[model samples]
Target: MTTTTELRVATDGLTKRYGGRAAVDGVSLTVRAGEVYGFLGPNGAGKTTTLRMLVGLVRPTAGTATVLGRDPGDPSACARIGVLIEGPGFYPYLSGRDNLRVLCRYRGLSDAAAESALERVGLRARAHDRFRGYSLGMKQRLGVAAAMLGDPDLLILDEPTNGLDPAGVAEMRSLITDLAADGHTVLLSSHMLDEVQDTCDRVGVIVAGSLVAESTVSELRGGTTIVVRATPYPRALAVARDVAGANRVAATDTGIRVDADAGVAPRLVRALVGAGIEVFDVHSSERSLEEAFFDMTRGSDSTGDDPEVSR
Candidate 1:
């Protein structure tokens, strides 16, 4: 009972090969319109290859992909999508406004759209400045403006925050969230799991060119560990053990750490109180997306598995 409107991007058995090896193997993914889909993986995990195929930069060696109901490489399909691949490219001597104008000209748009695009990226005040004079963050924003020129329905950005300071990273994250909120479908690829977890509505993780997990942030954090602190460590440990199915219950310097199922926090509190343990504080230790990424990608070398091809 799925509707066409529910799917913005779809791939089936997508594979890409190089020589005798596969750069991307039989991978399939679907993204809905207005949904922020995150592609996570380590370097050389085929994330870039998959995105290239999705954008028609490289033809798949084996599988098929569609964007907005048409082949990604189709000129009509490409027109509806905006992409900021690698980093933003511009003429060092050209003003920000001029750079966008150049892009618009190539896309068959009037120069009027260039100014508006600059405004959208919060660079209106500095629109006339040469690209060489802008900071790394400013350059990144300009790149985003270029991508927004056609007012495309879908946006694909890869590591948009690369080479930015902490504040720049924060700003980029906010801008991305705002883009999605404004009804733009975004497909983001990043090695920074924390950024992805914070910004994306759903995440698909790849390891060694193979999809290892796909889920919402909440679903991925379903069984996170909760750390409980009490006056007496041993007493807390004993009470934690009494709680049914408390795995890895151990006494730490401050209190006891236990891995338990979701919705068991309240139950643990009551059990500890009933057992006469002096409970000082209770808190859940949710795993950050970075932690989750490590857990998912650990023990696998980047080149361990042969790549898959999609034509």
Candidate 2:
């Protein structure tokens, strides 16, 4: 069981409205300590709004949210939480290291904190490069490094990999993973399904201002099922049904689909082989995060007055 102390962030029916329409409607989610939690949604969904409310950048129209056991925007809580929302702002003339140093000073932290943050984000080598000359990926890394200035307990990152090349995306993914491994609770919001699938321990999917699903990457994608193909179609089908209960067996276009794990695959092959059915191919099929997201938000579509616009 999860205790309140174990939760880094918790929201109950948390909502935000723009005029009459809701930008975030009744979202209840939890982020545990020292885990990477992904907030996933299509563009214009309520992800940003929900995050803003948690960080106290925006007030909730209804419901309650607790960050590090305090109200959103609480000074004490804010001190313990690091945030990087949208694009980061840094002076064009300032070096990456200097940029973090300025933020550190604002936070009442020492220059050493800035240097430590730069090293953590792999920006130590380019520490002296001006912000204007940095690549988009480098700038994003610097933003994250700035967020790490004080070694805050939680990081609330909104679209950390927004506009990056494939290599940059991979680097960001690795950095997020590294942060989580170092015992920092990370709340990452992104529209990229594959990135979330690869990086997040669990995910909350919001669609059209509503959270429709929340679960681990594996659970959301569903369990693995065995697909079998054999020469004797009819015989193979019968053997599959008998081996893996009739209810768990279904005939596909080429062969049989067994609603069972890979452990049942060997048994299935043996049974078919014993029955003189030549097994052609057998593999396990598991849905991707993209597939699961589509399944969860099949009918939802975003309209005017989104969270970003309202912000």
Candidate 3:
């Protein structure tokens, strides 16, 4: 567990209910400062409600959350947070710059902050373009700029890459990493597991409105699997199965997969070679984040989130 001093976002038994259906239930999360935290779950998994609660957009039915050491609903604490939730929503007829200027007026910030935000998101050139005329990526950038106008230390972004092309996704990825490097804590909610694996320092997997796993990206990778390829396939599989402490050794179309880390990699290779099997290549790697995610939620269902409306 991360120390309380380093925690910028903390929730205890957090829950939300619409009617009698629990959108979120007993969710506990701790996000440390200076880390890019990835929040992932399938559709209708209560991700949005959880984020909304953290940003004070939605009130929790039970439990509590603290942001920047104060109640999440506290006006002062909310000011310290920058949120880009439910994608970007701007006045379509207004220029992007004008839209931000309006937001600045509401926040009591000067035009300079708006300009800086535009520049940070690489939208200064298109700032004068009407929001309705902007591409999906441009609109997404505007959301990021709005979030930045506060000069906040914490950012909560939901599906920031929803409409980005490959290049745009790359740009957003770099931008997010830059934010973390600058000592800003970020909570990124997205369905892109590969992007999460590459960008986030830690990840929290939610299924059925509850966090099933929370750990650093590397730690989340969990056990390593040694993949082997050799000339003799059947014999190699036989040898792999005989190796002591070797977890799940199964054969694949291309090669055999051995559930063992690097420490036991050499042992597997040595055993195969000693068994008169010509071992060509042997490498160990953690299962992909996507694979692990599916495995975690294989039996889970959003059916549990049935919200029967009650006053």
- Show pairs that collide, candidate 2: none
lDDT of 2: 0.88
Candidate 2 lDDT over residue span 163-256, tens digit each? 6788778888998898899999999998788999999999999888888888999999998889998977988999999999999999888568
Report lDDT per candidate. 0.81, 0.88, 0.86
lDDT of 1 by residue, 1-311 (tens): 54776777888889888887777888888888898999988777888788888888889889888898999888988898988877688999999999999999999999989988887777899999999999888898898888888888899887777767777678778888988888889998887777888889988888777778888877765566778887566766777887845456877765677787547779888988887778888887777888788888888778544343211
Query: Which is superior by lDDT, 1 or 3?
Result: 3
Clashes of 2: 0
TM-score of 3: 0.89
Error of 2 at 89 (Å): 1.4
Clashes of 3: 2
Best by lDDT: 2
TM-score of 1: 0.87
203: Cα error in model 3, Å: 1.0
Query: What is candidate 1's CA lDDT for residue 221?
Result: 54
Which residue window of length 10 is worst by lDDT in model 2?
Answer: 302-311
